[model samples]
Target chain A: MAATYVSYFGFVIKSVRGMFTGGPRYYAWLSFLVLLMAAGAAAYYRQAVLGLGVTGMTDQVSWGLYIANFTFLVGVAAAAVMMVIPGYLYHDKAVKGGVLLGEMVAIGAILMCLLFVMADLGRPDRMWHMIPPFGKFNFPVSMLAWDVLVLNGYLLLNLHVPGYLLYKRYRGEEPAKWLYLPFVYISIVWAISIHTVTAFLYTGLAGRPFWNAAILAPRFIASAFCAGPAFIVLVLEIVRGWTRFPMGDRLITFLRQVVLIAGLINIFLLISEIFTEFYAASAHVASARYLFFGLHGHDALVPWIWTSISLNVLALLALVSRRFEQRGLVVRNLPLAMLIVAIWIEKGMGLVFPGFIPTPLGEIVEYLPSANEVVVSAGIWGLGLFVMTVLIKHAVDIETGAVAKNN
Target chain B: MSGGSRIRPGDVKRRGFLKLLTALTAGAVTAPADAEAFDLDAFLQKHFHQMSDDEKRRTLQRLEQDYNDKYERDDFTVVADGPTPGVKFAYALNLSKCIGCRRCVHACVQENNQHRGREERGDQVEYIRVLEMEKGSLDLEKAVHDYDHEVPAEDKYYMPVQCHHCNAAPCVKACPVEATWQEPDGIVVVDYNWCIGCRYCAAACPYWARKFNWIEPRLPADEINPDTHYLGNRPRYKGVMEKCTFCINRVRKGLNPACHDICPTGSRKFGNLLDKDSVIRRIIDHKRIYILKEEVGTDPSFYYFFD
Candidate 1:
């Protein structure tokens, strides 16, 4: 038992050492991420010193860019389940080889989600008050509490599965099924829960009519499946190009089918939501009005929502056409990139911002991300990418046998 | 392994990277001196309801001292008095009598030590919002809170809204840390120190009564209300949520809320709702009363009445 523990520690050390040994291009990419992260840290310092007031948030529109990014990234994290189910349940050999990379994306995305939540907090230092036993965890009651549990649990599950598998691979030994398979199955279900709970965080609010729809959870899951796999498709392509990981084109093709179906379902859910809000046009539709069009000349989000809608339609058409398959790699990947941005806008600012417009008192307060907020958000994204880049690099090296236990 | 060959520029680069990392971390850790200092006791302070009597007393004293130090005033006092026995507080406003002078808004600020800075600075926090609506319509969608005209336009009626202190307050249920809850006296109070500032409660409130301190609240020393309740109008920090506690400190001591006291037309009324003959109870029983957003089912203790 002690020998096993020591071996695991040695594996971690060697893997970390491998991450720092890449070429000049790798170093340049890492340096660029570091620069963005440093800028973000500086901007966040100003926000922390002054307050959230440094952002464009007001008492009327309390939440802004931080929460918007957090909401969108929760879906991104949950999308890892698309890979897990196919690799573990269906035993797809192509996907099975790349499951660790998918889980790495989950790790990176979850880390970003957590950072966004912290940035949104007014008393982040007092976060310990939410911990069980020490702080009053309003579990089973507050959806936010449920969100914390699910997000953290999902993070741990993603970490353990990949970590265990990578360690076993390093030893050139077969992984014991009992140690990691159960967690894989749990994660498949756990992935769905994180997004559902995040949806509940918004849906449970009775006062925000814009988010009170029963369709929210379904919409959240559908969008996660759509955007999650699309993002992984892009990452897998990068891995194939940058490393000798031998990822098959068949896996990318299979994921494109998943993205297509999930994207269709997402579009359907959105249409259903739009119809429900606009057909009858109740007073509760003020937020929807503010989002899709302008509310009393406050049209800040109108252009954004329309742009998102147009992109979704364009991407859906591109996915359906299959003409891109004959074209170059960039053209084939264009629809997926378009879908990602569309969903980002739809779920991020498109969903969170409008909920606060036409404040509960029937006042309209428009919110825009200040320069500081944008920098902080970009910094977090840079950090997530940096983490994922290192993690994937290490995992790929292990798979390629560049670093071995015997050596 | 040719260690000597590899150690030259690589070591220098690694050292440079480490130095950069260390500088970034140090920059992140070192907050401005005037920003809220890291207080160990304050950081580790227990939840307001969970603290024992002695703990509560110490916490209150610490808060008072912190406030005094921040404002450079020695007279700041914080009280942790609990709910008075057998008293269920409620409020009523005579809608017909209200003239929308906005005196209650300013008075609440003075009495509560609300931020008095410009709105652009995000420190301008006000508890009461007076809405001017068309006389014949109750549709809140058209109600204007920023009407700049003179008192009570002929075609408009005024409705002033603040924290309703609901019997089934959604904000309390929405609080992830249980930072806000309904007290024994039926007042929904927030433990400002315990709040995580996620603003979920503010979103859950249909009345839009809850407010967030986006920036460090700025109250001039001369304008600071020295007497404060721990769960009430104790000066708040930047990034916490606070709202009208129906003036928890004043009401528990048998004084009316500043909003109720400053109403120029005697439009606001407050009393112990548990009492059979209190003015609030009489108004609820005898007058035509309305609860804002009744469909939301908050079951507010606050009511609007017409004589």
Candidate 2:
């Protein structure tokens, strides 16, 4: 037993050391990420010292960019299930080869989600109060508490699955079914729960009519499947181009089909939400009005929502058109990139920002993230990308037998 | 003057540099000087309700010392008194008598030690927001809270909203750490030290009563209210949620709230809801009363009445 633990420890140390040794282009990319992360740390330090007042947030619109980004990234983290379902349930060999990479993306995305939540907090130092036993954990009651549990749970599942699989691969042994199979299945369900709980964070609030719709959870799931697979398809392409990871074109085609169907359903759910909000025209429609058009001539989000809608339509059309099948790599990937960006805006700025407009007291105060906020957000994204680059590179090296135990 | 020649590059650069310098200077001057040191006492302090009697006393002493040092007043004290038994506090406002003079708004700020800096400084927190509404319409969408006109416009009525201290308070339920809860007296209070400042409670409140300390609260030493309840007006830190405690300190001592006392028209009323002879009970029993956003089902202790 002790021998096994030592071997595992050795494997981790060697794999991590190997991650530091890469090509010139990889070094340049890492350096750039480091620069971004440094900028982010500096900005966050200033914010901590000066307070959230440095951001554009006010008592009128209490939440702003950080929460918006946190909400959107939760979907991205949940999207890893798209890879899990096909790879494990259907036994697709091409996808099974890349599931570990997909889980690595989940790890990176979840890290970003937690960081965004931390960035949004006013008393992050007092976060220990949420811990169980030692501090109060208002579980089953506060949706935020449920979110903390599910997010951390999802992160653990992803970490264990990928870690166990890679260690077995490094040792050139087949992983026992019981060791990882049950977790794979549980992770699929857990993935859905993470995003559903995140949606509940917004939907459970009776105060914000804009987010009170039953359709929100379904919309979150639909968008997650679409954006999640679309993102993986893009990452798989990069892995295929940059390294000898042996990714087949067939996996890309399969993920594209998933994205196409999920994207259609996402658009359908969005239409349902729009119809429900606009058709009835209740007093609750104030927020929706502010989002889709202008409310009392305070139309900060009108352009944003329209642009998101137009992009969603265009991306869905591109996915459906024969041109997607006939085109080369760049042409095919454009729609996927477009879909990712559209969902980011639709879920982040288009969803979270409008909920605060026409505040509960019927006040309309527009919120735009300050430059400091934008810098901080960028730094987090840079950190996530840096983490993913190192993780995926190490996993690819192990899988390709380039960093085997014998070496 | 030609558009191209309106400004020289040298002049523009110098102006920009001066502006940046002024902003930096202002930020430096306003930034809390004591913020650099790690506050071990605050870090290790237990939740208000969870602390033992001795711990509570020690915590209160530490807080009093901090406040005294910051405000330069040795008389400042932090009281952690429990709720008065058998007293369920409630409030009522006579809508017909309200003149919208905004005296209650300023009075609450003074009594509560709320942030009093300009908006640009990020410390302008006022618990009571007076909405100027069209008398004929019940629609809040048409209500204006930022009116600059004279008192009591011909067709307008003023509605001042604060923490309703709901029977089933959504903000209390929304707190992930149980940092805020309804006291025995039906007043909802937040442990400023325990809050993580996620602002979920702020979003959950239909009345928009809870406020976040976006910046460190800047209370001028002279304006600081020394008589403070621990859960009520004791100074709050940046990144925590605070709300109207229904004047927990004053009401428990048989004194009316600052807002109620300062109302010139006798429009605001406060008393024990559990007492049958209380003015709040009398108003609810006899007057045409309305609960704001009753559809939300918060069951607020506060009511609006037509006298």
Best by DockQ: 2
Judging by lDDT against the true structure, name the best candidate.
Answer: 1
> lDDT tens string, model 2, B101-160?
889988999999987755433236778888889988878889877676789899899999
> Fraction of true contacts reproduced, model 2?
0.71
Each predicted complex: what DockQ? 0.33, 0.43
Q: How high is the TM-score of chain A in model 2?
A: 0.98
Candidate 2: where are CA atoms >4 Å away? B1-31, B34-36, B119-123
TM-score for candidate 2, please give it. 0.95
Q: Give the root-mean-square deviation of each candidate in angstroms.
A: 8.3, 4.8
Q: State model 1's lDDT.
A: 0.86
iRMSD computed for candidate 1 = 14.3
Q: Write the per-residue lDDT of candidate 1 for residues A271-315, one digit (tens) a residue.
A: 999998899998899999989989888898988888888988899
**Candidate 2 lDDT, A190-294, residue by residue in tens:** 999999999998898888899888899999999988988888888898999889998887888888998999999999988888898889888899988888889
Full-model lDDT for every candidate: 0.86, 0.85
Q: What's candidate 2's i-RMS value?
A: 8.7
**Would you estimate the TM-scores of all the predictions?**
0.94, 0.95
